[model samples]
Target chain A: METELSKRLGIEHAIFGFTPFPAVAAAISRAGGLGVLGAVRYTAPGDLARDLDWMQEHTGGRPYGLDVVMPAGKVEGVTEADVEAMIPEGHRRFVEELLTKHGVPPLPAGEASGWRITGWMEHVARSQLDVAFDYPIKLLANALGSPPADVVGRAHDRGVLVAALAGSAVHARRHAEAGIDIVVAQGYEAGGHTGEIASMVLTPEVVDAVGPLPVLAAGGIGSGEQIAAGLALGAQGVWLGSVWLTTTEADLHSRALTAKLLAAGSGDTVRSRALTGKPARQLRTEWTDAWDDPDGPGTLPMPLQGLLVAEAVSRIQKHGTEPLLGTPVGQIVGRMNSERSVRQVFDELTRGFERAVDRVQRIAGRSAS
Target chain B: METELSKRLGIEHAIFGFTPFPAVAAAISRAGGLGVLGAVRYTAPGDLARDLDWMQEHTGGRPYGLDVVMPAGKVEGVTEADVEAMIPEGHRRFVEELLTKHGVPPLPAGEASGWRITGWMEHVARSQLDVAFDYPIKLLANALGSPPADVVGRAHDRGVLVAALAGSAVHARRHAEAGIDIVVAQGYEAGGHTGEIASMVLTPEVVDAVGPLPVLAAGGIGSGEQIAAGLALGAQGVWLGSVWLTTTEADLHSRALTAKLLAAGSGDTVRSRALTGKPARQLRTEWTDAWDDPDGPGTLPMPLQGLLVAEAVSRIQKHGTEPLLGTPVGQIVGRMNSERSVRQVFDELTRGFERAVDRVQRIAGRSAS
Candidate 1:
């Protein structure tokens, strides 16, 4: 039960549960694993503070973490204004037109207007970081890239561990170089922005490459056996995301989308830039299909495309019943049909791990017998 | 332009490919594709001859295929006869001793003799159906699983096409149900026995779940446009086995397993059962650490485990360059340092296909302004 990662996170299990909702985070910590709240969707500082406060109260002093976005490489040399300027009138028109073509209605004028790319994204993300620091978050994670030095230093100052997601070993080294406490070797099979490496190869490679820095295997890992495999391959622990997305407490957008995810097999997802402007795996949907169309305007760079389409995403959640509007998830989402409580999910993983161990033992016994 | 697959077998594109190797039959012709030969390691007399002849002579004079297994897959499933029956007593004692001390190898061996499990493998695989079939071979492919049924049938019936190999999509369906003229949906990154499922989501989804089949799209797909995304996902062409495995009409093995693949990118290869019994993708190496570890046992079923350990495989090819022991391939194999000729490995496929008509039109005449 005492894993290297558990020692690092100062928790009983290295199970770092991520969720955008506070209730789920608190629940996971209550279930004995650390629940990390995602700050990506929090628009206001006060909103994050309130959520963290609630999580702290509910978790009963059990430790937890916080996740923020800090993209390593963005369109360089372009100021926020410049990025906004680069958003072509035609491109904006095209997105609007495409939405219309797809039966999505235009946003009412002046409803959340003047949303500039990069400008608001960085501001909102940093603000959430400030809010996160205000609480007793045990770990601070950057989902997109390495944390800014200030963020890392501030978290360390607050006695919080720092974790960063790395899509490749080179990225892993960058995080190590930046003095990160933990590195998440996320393969393409993971939800959200991920690279094209599988867990089997990436975990050990990252662990070896990082030279002792604790590496948590992410992507396509839902079962206890997969977690055990990660540990077998040198990962200190396994970081799960999609598995949480299908949990009973997850505040998923639609019942239909949830149903689709539950019904899907591991093979049904894809890594496409249509959602986040980076290759993040998710259930293939009509929205992604449009961007994938050979003849359509290719996906624009991050923030810009994301900004242009945020309202559409909001609307899709509001009304879209199609598979295309589902949020990011990993290939493992395929095996995530049944709804289980976060506690039940952990129990199932533990059972699966035991089964894997028993199976391997049996296989070895055959040669002896 | 008239290669064996084209001149003798007569298919629009002489290329043939499929997965689980067993389903090459309908996979090829269904899409007006050719099912190449597969299962060099396991070919029964009737299965091999029927597959080759059926594909070659059946495609209405259209070129079809042939694929021969040349030892690949990892986890050499070899044991001396005495060892096979009772673990040689010596090996058994060693294993038991190790288990008693270490609480069992990290992964135990299966409850069966590795040899016995694969006892019938070689007899069925090395049959060399190509020698018996009188039809001209348009293409040949090999990997895990048995070759497709119709691959031999259609080849002999029409004197036209043939095909083989596949990694995922119910391996059985690609040949049995999809009616693949030729089938293979190798991972985006795989060396052998693949099922890593990248090819941007296992091209063809095993060719639309095996219908109007005639797939090739093997692992990594090694080029821009890759026959224009294998005819934009409904692959009429695209077959690659470790683009890096050295190529020389004479030194195919030597040239294939060099250090070039070792230093390849994250996109390089995946671990899968195509090579060993278990799904595995790794750079080829003398240590062949993948299969040797008692912890993982790493091998899976069929010709893969046999192919990986076969004496003829690179272990003996170049004076035991352990690195060169297993098969090396996939889209990532494009890094293979040296190149060879089947007209330089069918110039149209290796290089020409990038600038082929369909590709040109995809990027043609876009307004730069």
Candidate 2:
């Protein structure tokens, strides 16, 4: 199950479990795959630092990574008030109408807006990176695009690997040019923000384009057979995200967990811009559908869309309406119909990977003989 | 390059080139891979018979297959006149306006509509199947869904292997249950009509779901490396369509040839329903964009949409305008930037497969030693 990339990263296998839950990350690391904690939701650097501190205590001295969302071309200088003002009145009315239609009750006056990323900006991501460097972080990944050259340099200076998730070979080249240690070629079949290319086509292109730089295939990969496919596509490793969502270690809303487990199919998710002002793959629900209505105002760009929908998401979450509730996920959610421990997932991935390798080797050996 | 599936099929490599071009199909068969001629464009059984006869003459006795598009659930009992009456006046106006804006000349009165697919009906496909069975066809493949049970039975009775292209594991299971000999799991990244899942994830799932039935990976696969990836994902073979488009043997129109070579990229295609009444991946063009416009009437379902757009397509092709010109293709068009003979393309595929296997072997050997 081990790969050259895994040996280099000092892990038992080249499996990366990226999740917002610290417990899941720690559990995955304990299970021998490098677990990466998604730090974008932690608005404050102190919160991320504390979460990492908690994660480190449970990881049994194994290495883990931090994932920050800093899209290379985010709009700057727009204050929250300014961005809020940019959302049209018609969009607000549409959202209110959609909530009524879906039977989602309004939120209380003083309830929190729930977990949302404010680290989409470069400066905010830089603050998170500073906190990450203070810990024993072995890797720092940029989820949306290539990290700035200085960020890559800073991580390299401290012996931490700089990884970037690219939706295309063009983006992968940008990462390699900017001194990224690893390129995660995230295909359209992946959850959240993804490019149009599929992992089967994109992984080898990224590997060839980067020329010796390690490539980690991502998107539509939740099984060991897929991991072997990634390796065959010239990827040195694989970076997985949504597969961790239904694990026992994950912190999920009851409605979301139930929805994912019972209702989600390979075609259940859609690449919609409603959630984050970007085309992110998520569970297709009435909430996403209403936002995409032709008669309603179209979605705003990234930060504005996220900002506009924060309260609506909060209300939806509070009401626990199945039609209004959703989660970011890939088509792989079809295979994630049951809950398993993080360690159990790791075992399956490794065992399945070994079996796939044996199959390939048997074929190769027969040919050679 | 040989796979157990290929050996069973009596081929040198586990490669299947599915193309509408007879020369390309025959050339692929002559070059050691099985060639499957797409018969969706064959408006009549006689047309398919004539084409298959030509292919047989060129194939030098090598086994070849026939591909017919018969999606599982198309509306029946609606005549061409009945469906033509269903198209809205606004959609008709919009198509006319788009063509007029592009300066496309009107078609001469009573020239046959450039595209016709009355054969999408079960009876029509059955007629084509009878014609196919009369020939030396080694296989009969349904491009869109599980073939009718009787169609599968008829193929089996005639000593022809039954195959079906599935976009999902659920579809693949249906094919296996219907007695399909092979399941081609086509990913979203593939050209033409594709399902939402990526091949990296879908191949293994389809292979597992189909049990002993052979699985051929399709979508976003143009190179030998991708072919290796398909096998690694548990597919017994790889099925390709768009890669053959740019080959010298392809029967592409001049504008289409230019569009594919000069403009199509991995990201330049969109899954638009403007063509064939289904979400088919095609080279993104102003024609597709106009049809997807929110202001315009949304596309009608299958045969209706195809019929509605036929005249518009005729004018566009006649005009040869770059913005309106398009072709069904996969994201693999990024790699099909040059014109090679079918033999050259086949050589590259097998050579690349060997290189990828050697790379995998070296890594596996290193770990073992």
Number of the top-ranking candidate, with DockQ as the measure: 2
Model 2, span B254-301: residue lDDT tens: 655565555566888899998887899998889899888877788988
Those runs of model 1 whose alpha carbons end farther than 4 Å from true positions after fitting are A72-82, A107-120, A321-323, A366-369, B1-166, B172-188, B192-259, B268-369
lDDT (Cα, tens digit) per residue for candidate 1, span B94-138: 333433443322223333222123323433444554454554654
| lDDT by residue (tens digit), candidate 2, A5-38 | 7887888778898999999999999998899999
Candidate 2 residues lying further than 4 Å off, grouped into runs, are: A1-4, A71-78, A89-111, A121-123, A253-259, A364-369, B44-47, B71-79, B88-90, B106-114, B119-124, B362-369
User: Best candidate per TM-score, number?
Assistant: 2
DockQ of 2: 0.58
Expressed between 0 and 1, the share of native interface contacts present in candidate 2 is 0.68
Ten-residue segment with the worst summed lDDT in candidate 1 chain A? A360-369
Tens digits of per-residue lDDT, candidate 1, A191-255, equal 88887665544665687689688888787677765554455455667788888877888887688
Tell me the lDDT of candidate 1. Answer: 0.58
Q: Output the worst ten-in-a-row residue range by lDDT, candidate 2 chain A.
A: A360-369
TM-score of each: 0.60, 0.92
